[model samples]
Target: MAERTRQNNGNGKHVWRGIVIAILAVIVLAAFISSRKGEVPVRVDHVTKQDLITTISTNGKVEPMENFEAHAPAPTTVRKIYVREGQRVRQGELLMQLDDADARAQAARALAQTKAAEADQHAIQSGGTQEEVLNTRSELVKAQAERDSAQKNYDAVQKLAQTGAAAPAEVREAASRLTAAQAQLKVLQDKQQDRYSRPEVNRVEAQVEQARASYTAAQDLLKHSEIRAPFEGTVYSIPIKQGEYVQQGELLIQLANLRRVQVRAFVDEPELGKLAVNQPVTVSWDALPGKIWRGEISQMPYTITTYGTRNVGQVLCAVDNEDSRLLPNINVTVNVSIANKKDVVTIAREALHEDENGRYVYVIRNGHLERQTVEAGIANNTRIEIMNGVQPGEVIALNSMNAGTPLRPGLEVRAR
Candidate 1:
């Protein structure tokens, strides 16, 4: 029994010793793995020389450069509509006509009055017209004859009354007749006294001038009845129909010269300051894909205003639209090239960092990260130009995480 017990005890000791050896090996392996995990694994890409661009993108709308809108000049019926929407017209081409019957009658009446006033003015300036002066003289002669006859009868009646051959009533009647004739003669003499007076001539001339102005105004109104195109353009809109009555100043026709198009970009206030005249602009339409229109900033915003939820400024850009595919008032997207650099070494924008010192990036060299202060040139949304402090063919770390901390100088990194 003692011999059996001794053998069992020896076997137990060997088993415990083997177990301790396995535990110690496991501890050492775990420690080595933990140390390896301290280094951050990062993705890296090498900088290369390529064209770099910086742009500000915003929404915009199209407008016509040369546009015309015609309106009704007065209350009248549209007698004829000669053009429809989307019709091309030349300068002086007739687009519509209004009912001119009333206008023509007005012109005729004004012309007759003007002629009569002119004749009266001429007569006053030259001692009256020949016919008027002759009639006046004849009227004077008739008045004189009547007055003499009345006076002779009154004298006869007075003589007869004195000799008791006529009644008293007869004598009074004769005296009244003579008085009436004398008054009539005096009125005629006064009328002929100032036939060519200055005031009379001036008054006649003033009447003629007033009538002439009315005649001219009526003629102009008559001309307005025929609506003609003021310039060469395309008729884009016509709002009235034939035989429709329209009030004064109502919109009638809209014409536009679409050879050139203008884009009004509503840029946010933060981006407004970056805009300048002659900056290159690219436009794209949602309705059409894979198409682009180019232009330059023709005008800058003079002030800021609110558009929708954004405080924006309007920037006007002019573009060539010879094919006329870009219509007015169409909404579009615009990209303004604020800066550009070509054939330069560039890095991912995610790799850039800034501090009080300056802008910088992390360069991967010898399996470690080196902090580099770089002068950046042009930057787009994804990438940026490295003007200095970094060279082409050098790898840069995209991101580094050290136990929830950012990367810094001398940080070991494993490239992925």
Candidate 2:
């Protein structure tokens, strides 16, 4: 029994020793793997001589260079819409017609009032109307005749009195009759001369002027009732339907010359300094995929404003749309070409880094990273122009394959 127990103990000792040896082998292998991981895998690119284009992209809205809008001249129903929306109309072509019956009636009433005022003004200037002047003249003539007759009777009575063929009382009575007739004639002449005072004449003239102005306003309203295209343009908006009642000053129609359009681009504040008038611009609309319109900077922003969460400046670009496909108020993407350089030393933008010293990049040489300071010129979203410090044909590190790996000087790297 003692011999059998010793045999079992010996087998147990061997099993423990094998298990310890296997654990030591695993520890050595793990150390070897850790030493290999010191060299980090990184993305790399070659600095090459190529054309570089720096552009600023932002959102914008289209607007017409020349636009027109019409409103209802009065509270009236729309009589007819002569031109449909999107129809091109020539200058002086009628676009819409409103119910002008009221307008015409108003105009007629104004005309009648104007004529009456003018007649009154003329009568006041001439002392009276034609009929009144004639009546005054007739009365004056009768007074003059009566005065002459009285003078003749008075002279005859005086002569009789001198010849003792007339009594004194009769002569006196004839003189009194002559005097009364002369007084009546003088009064009529004074009445004609003092018919209208200065204030009265001025009041009448003012009335005439006011009436004429009213007539002109009425005529203007009548003309506007029939809306016409003042210039050649496309009818873009017609808010009122035929026979629809609208109030005065309500919007009715809108049209614009769409051959030439303006793009109001909202550029972020940081990009404003890179913009200038006459810079080339390209615009694209999501609604029309793959279609691009070319333009130039026509105006620069005078002030900065908040747009959503970003501070932006409004830049205006003039674009040619001979086909008129770019409509007003359509949202579009605008790309302003800030710089276009040819045959320049360029590198991938991800390779470039900046710190307190200056801008820099990680140059790869002999499987190791070297921190090289660089002067950058024009840059786009994915590429940058290296003015100096980094020459063409040099390999540069973009980033590490592993997120936890950081790039540093003298660090060993394996290009991926």
Candidate 3:
């Protein structure tokens, strides 16, 4: 009986060991299958022959062709404004008016003074007329007749003194009076000559011209009170209201021409050499997405700008706008195509990689990843041109991979 019991215990132990071994084997198989399922799958794309375009992209703003600020020319109170903000205006259209009552009064006074001066100048230029000359001559003749009578008396007195028929004191008094009369006659003759040729008249003529110029200046100021638009444009802003006092050079309104818009963008110095006049460009505004406006490079600034660790040069592009949607200072994006190539080997931009040895890519050969050194050319945001070391229809890995990542040239790979 003891021997039988020992045999049964041994048999039970052996059966238990066998069952445990089978369960371990099943667990190992299940783990191997789960590990295979957890492995990360890589994605890839194929190189192909297609047209490749290289473009430079940057953000910009749309600005009007011309922007101007209108200011008050002189200090005055606003009388009336004909237009409001955002109003369309034509060249020479009246915009605003200032109280010009004082200006008008001043101008009138200046004109009156100018007219009086002119009349005085005309009279001076044309010296005394024939009648006035004759009148002066008559006065001179009368003075001469009186002087002749005095001279005769003096001559008679001298003869008496010589004959000793009168006192010497009386003869001396007569001689003094004769001398005064002759001096008076000479003064009259000189006065008559001055009437014909008056030199002072020319000085009066200069004063008249000065007064006329002042009058013209006052008239111009009065006209300037009625402000007019300088060019055809839309009114952007109106800062002044009627009865508001504005100083000289104060902001009154703003204007801009919206028909033609320009995009001002900056380009790096390295890319500056690739830009030229009339180069084709494509522009899109943030306000109007999916709408590309075609344009050309209109101007390139000669000087470079330095701003907070950035060095760039300015480039201006002229865009045509038929709908007049583009306004001043609207942000935009620009794409300038620098070059294009056709029938070129190209791949997605994600396929290219860089390291210490320079640019490289991974190509699949015989179902395995193979390292490839490539020379790249013009690249756009989507694809890059493969200049050399690659061919068309070749499979390339899209994502980056490690060098010692257990990849073989001919090993089978399941591209995700």
Best by lDDT: 2
Which ranges of candidate 2 are over 4 A from the true structure?
A: 1-38, 148-179, 198-200
Lowest summed lDDT across 10 adjacent residues in model 3 is found at 400-409
Better of 1 and 3 by lDDT: 1
- Index of the highest-TM-score prediction: 2
Residue-wise lDDT of candidate 3 within 103-190, one digit each (tens)? 8888999999898887766554443555666776787788788789888888898888888987889888888887888898887776
lDDT of 1 by residue, 1-416 (tens): 99999999999999999999999999999999987786788878788899988999999999989988877767889999999887889999999999888889989999999999998977776557888778888999999999999999999999999999999999999999999999989977876766666787888889999999989988988998888998887887787888999998988888888777899999999998788999999999998998899999999999999999999999999987776778878999999999888798898888888999999989998878899999988889898998899999999998864457567788888877
Provide the overall lDDT of each model, using Cα atoms, as 2-decimal numbers.
0.89, 0.93, 0.80
Q: List the residue pairs that clash in candidate 1.
A: none
Write one digit per residue (lDDT tens) for candidate 2, span 132-181: 88888899999999999999999999999999999999999999999999
C-alpha RMSD between model 2 and the true structure? 7.9
TM-score, candidate 3, is: 0.69
- What is the Cα-based TM-score of model 2? 0.82
Report the Cα lDDT for residue 87, model 3: 80
Candidate 3: stretches off by over 4 Å: 1-40, 48-51, 59-63, 127-210, 342-344, 354-358, 388-393, 400-413
Q: TM-score of the candidate numbered 1?
A: 0.69
